[model samples]
Target: MSFELRRATVEDLSFARELTSQNMLRYYIEFELPWQDHAFDVAWSERQNWLIVRDSVPVGYVSLSRDMRALYIRELQVAEAFHRQGAGSWAIDQVIDIARGERRPAIRLTVFENNPARSLYERKGLQVQGRDECFLRMQLDISTPVL
Candidate 1:
């Protein structure tokens, strides 16, 4: 299936919210409806950091927000059927492309220590920059990876 990423518009909000809810329920065991409302509010309030699309049947969702000086990836989820494909990788690459387009310093995110996506992030150039007992503070520096 072919896919493309574009800025979210008002017309796409409902679809975005639907995709968000579906993915959240399937992948995020800690999901909450109120949080989804808050996220929708934040994402729609400022369209700078959210992208949602369905190449065919709504493959995934991702939300990135700027925090302090660093860009924080607030959420990313690929639909159950779309997992293990390149949907996520392309979405994340788009995030990096956005960062590059804006000339940002880095992208930072927190992930559950046991989550499988950590491996994907690591392979895609994200690293554990800091951490606590439960979560890892990962950062993707917008520079060439070390060889």
Candidate 2:
């Protein structure tokens, strides 16, 4: 199956809310943080969010921000029905390509410490840069050959 990502606009807020509420509640539980509407509010305003579409239907979303130093992945989530289907991996590869094409030195993100997606990030060539109480920061150095 082919996948495409399109910029998500305010009209897509309900789509994002549905996906996040269904699939991402565990992350908040694991971190002992309460889910809040403001979380999505801030994300909607602050990040470049995209919907991952499969055959014209939205199945997932990824939010990212690019700064002079790095391309940061704010969030990545695919519907439970789409797990193990390579959509997430493909999305990450697309983001990596974006970083490389834009001449960014690295891609950076923080995964909740116990989130299983940490392993996926590692498999995609991101290294554990550091960890704090709530999250583990990871970085993939796109300027090097490892990617």
Q: What is candidate 1's lDDT per residue for 42-100, written digit by digit as tens? A: 66557453454565455666777785466777777676777888878888888888777
| CA-only RMSD, every prediction | 4.1, 2.4
55-136 per-residue lDDT for model 2 (tens digits):
9999899999989889999888898899889889999998999898888999999988877888899999999999988899
Pairs of residues at least 3 apart in sequence or in different chains that clash in candidate 2: none
TM-score of 1: 0.72
TM-score winner among the candidates? 2
TM per candidate comes to: 0.72, 0.92
Off by over 4 Å in 1: 10-49, 52-56, 144-147
Model 1 clash pairs are none
Q: Model 1: how far is 11 from its true place, Å? A: 5.6
Q: Model 1, 31: alpha-carbon shift in Å?
A: 11
Q: Clash totals for all models, in order?
A: 0, 0
- Model 2 — which ten-residue stretch has the worst lDDT? 138-147
